[model samples]
Target: MGAFGRMRNSLSFTPPDLQEARLEPVRRRIVFYIPGYDPEARTRYRLLFVREWTRYTKRFGGGRREISRAELSQDGLVQSWTVSAPEQGDGAETRYDVLLWDDIVARDFARSRFLSVALLIVGTLQTILSGLLFRFYRLSWKYGNVILYPFVMVILLAALSVAIAALVHAHLGDWFGHSLGLPLWVSLPLGVIAGLVWIKAIEAFLNRVFFWQLLNDWVFNWQHGQGRRPDYERRLDAFAEHILSSVAARDEAGHSTDEVMIVGHSSGGLTAAEVAARVLARDTSIGTSGANLSLATLGSGLPLVAMQPAAARLRGEIARLVTDRRIVWCDFHAPQDWMNFPGFNPLHDLKLRLCGQPVANPLVRSARFRDLLCPETYRRVRFRPFRMHFQFLLANERPGAYDFFAMTLGPRRLREQVLAPDAYSEPEPAVPL
Candidate 1:
């Protein structure tokens, strides 16, 4: 069998072997999950998680994994779900409280078209400059491709813009002036407006293919406040308070708190890291006192922003996260996902000159899509890199080393599963399957 064949076979479903995982005492759990640059309502994510969990239960639930319908909060920013199953030959219920931070991303999508276009121009230039510098640094061959693809796409867009302008002037100029009997001054401005409209339309079409909105947002935030948005800060504060409250409730009830895992996907990776850093900032003994705090950043785009020289504030936050021994940070990267910088290390890649002592904490691991999907499903979506990026949050087609639902809702704690001896590694891409 080839590598792909082996990967598929390895992921084939087997009866649930509860013995493979070390059983932990039943305790309350909390997860603060942040989605990518998405503008969809929180209900969308709620349904998505429900659907994925349902699929997981059908596949490997072994008629044991039972999940409750996700109950949305009145404010609609938080959702809570409960999962129960027999573990270690004992029946115990695990309460999974998930808080989704999504307001800022929706606000980003609601920006005026005029402002979006203006920011696009500025962001495009910034992206080109950053790409060139990344290539100059010789980070990786993949980095070169990342730089080349966007630069080439932008050039193509520019060429298309020029072509549309020329076509408008050629076909419409004479007709407007003579047949419509419009003066040259009036005709010229109309033609220009028509050309600009065509360009904007084409830009919108290209965005579906290249995801320019994410790039534009990243650049805008980096240049503006280095990924610091007031709404995001407010939400982060709320999340921290929720964590403390959950821990407090467990304490008052005389139950031990299991774990608090902050999961960030795509751009949410950056947000998750910063939020965890802030929580530590406010209370340095948070993880040490009660529940173990952990961070799982899946398909994170941290390098996209951190690579830029203007991302000083973000870098500072990252450096703080690195040295904080209380938090367990596990960064999962997939080589197949072009949306994230696979195998990139933020501290070394950004070349941070930190003011405080630096420590290596984030153990980079590979979330291989090949191992997660069936052969047919993997082959079908392998070429659709963007969809593959989202596979991080969805249920695995077949269980293997890493399962998102299992991490969040399974019997074992995040720290127990991820902090195992072979569960961590330095920043490096997993070998392609």
Candidate 2:
């Protein structure tokens, strides 16, 4: 009991303000999931969703969580599946479309070692020189460390490798020359060989810890922010078109869809925001097309690129989305996740309202991971940065105000959760007849 109290006290965070409002329950929903900078294909996420959704059902014990077999689109741009819960509310069905861009991420991660390191250096300099790193520190010190991690790790590793090479050259030089009767000059090459071996070992260790993967992510962000990646822009356009088509489609019963939710996690949050803005640009009346349109960005790294001076295009998109107020936007952040910015109101934080028209958006809300997970579970994952970051997309150990499965698959609309989480997250107590 004491441990639990300490856990709660330690992990608690104040959530942003959202007005109370009653929203209609959803009968049919469409979810477009944009993943972060991961090289894995959509199939991996499908399996994870299946696994976690099953766990969610067991934990909450509502009913069977029936998910259809995933189907890949002919164009191979998306993989989709259906989820149904017959006993929840009025019976809800959700179609999930997993947007595919992992191939691009894989290509980024597959670059030559020399090229990758060079890009990392370039990215680090840009981030620091642009004053974005200091701005990040001012916004959230922990998150600033996230941005600094790759560069710091690289420097530390290089120093260690050089020290190892020097030590080998100094101490082992005489011994090797005497043992093999080789010239003392051969020790220099041996030391160089030792340094190379150390570097290889360090590379293996970095791969195991996802350090290189994250470094590549930073490089990708820098490139994408500078508008150097035309591939991303093209993909964003395609994603926008796909969303527009999905929202326009009618169900098998010839009835319009109830709600369309675009969910972006981690770096995908930037992509999701751009996609939403693009959809709005193509069709100004997308929000008023009788379908409830909402965007949910969870543990997003949008600020990483959006905060840069070279990211005016992204800022414009964000401003468009923020000032419009037509589509509902909610950003779910966790204080514990160093990878995301919590308590970030895009309008005020980015001064987007000042950039364009004034309007409040992206009702920033904390995921309250501690409240949702058990004390033991929370303790185990508290220090694991990646796990805590990914927790936004995973199932909670205990039901709470934030449940990814509940928000996406349950009968409630995402708008309701954004507006009045306290009111809509759980059912009210029974009254006497």
Candidate 3:
């Protein structure tokens, strides 16, 4: 059988094997980090994490904690690292693995400009014809603007280019025709050349401002929503298999893991959900394996694709995950981040139905950037949309409930952090012994 066939067969359903849960401080935790559509994430994420974690240590006072060097997997699909912080609550050791898929993103970004613009036009037309554009606006006006920003900019840039070309053509045409006694043909081609030159001139600026990136992002959403991106599904399968292997692998003395957490940021939110669903479907016994499985989606852009009618696969996966009691899911969103959907309920708002009793698997909470950052810092970054969106992953200015480092490296398990009514206040910096 083919690789896809083998994957399908391996995911055949298994019988349920539910068992009692043992919840405690996380000692040996394994984390799978799924990033969004950013092409630079492969190297950028590690550096970003290290920089933010250092900032985190300084702010929260766990200076003694140290992160080990990263080790890449055989297939180069994952970059794994270990973070040991023995001074925290009861001492914790966490292994973090970043699921790599930035290669695909790079390819998308490197495609021909004609193809990119064509895809953008197609995606925009689909959004408009399918009525998703209006629906998106009704759901989140900010998101609606995000969807339209690229198209609008493209149009404005084209208009500006045309205006410049026309002005140049008039001056050149006057010189060539009236003064030099030349034909209109000379000025016409020069006008076209002038327009092309203008577009070429501003290409770097547009890229720096993320114009093409956002266009490609929307195109990805459009293609993936229509089930055209099998590459992403295959990547998710690999991610699921890795998670299952991690769960099944025994330590030196045959000890099971304490917790297995999958963190999905931005568009990766739905990707992480699909991974957990596949794991559960393949082996129902995972729930009884004595390891806590938790899904944490930060600044999740779930609705961007899940709202599409053709995304039945994603919707089904989300449904299965939501009804499952074994895995704990928490979604964090901030009002300041226009890129994410805040206060969204998958079951209620998205209308996903459950087979059995209602399950509130995803405990939705506000990241509350206003509370997480100091007034001065918040004011500086609040207007910056991408900065606010990334705040979910960055270290907090103050000790708040949504500290990424605290939830991942601190002693507390994700479930504990999610269930606690009070904020996760970090301890004072440990004095050197």
Residue-level lDDT of model 3, residues 256-335, one tens digit each, is 57888899998887778888899889988876557778889988878888889888888888888777878888888777
lDDT of each: 0.64, 0.77, 0.78
Model 1 Cα shift for residue 206 (angstroms) = 5.0
**Leading candidate by TM-score:** 3
Candidate 3, pairs of clashing residues: none
- TM-score of model 3 vs. true structure: 0.89
Q: What are the runs in model 1 whose C-alpha is more than 4 Å off?
A: 1-26, 86-98, 130-162, 175-182, 199-212, 224-228, 352-360, 419-433
- Residue pairs in collision within model 1: none
Quality of model 3 by C-alpha lDDT = 0.78
Residue-pair clashes per prediction, in order, are 0, 0, 0
Q: Per-residue lDDT of 1-433 in model 2, one digit per residue for the tens?
A: 3321222222222223322333667888899999999898675799889888766656656566578999988888899999875664544689999999998998888778778878888888878887778777766677778778888888887788788877777765666444444456887788777876987866678888878878899899988888899998999999999998776665445856778889899999888989999988998887665677788899988988888778888888888777665677878888888788776666555745445355546666788898877788889999899999989888777657777987887778776765556675363223211
Q: What RMSD, rounded to one decimal, does every model reach?
A: 7.7, 5.4, 8.1
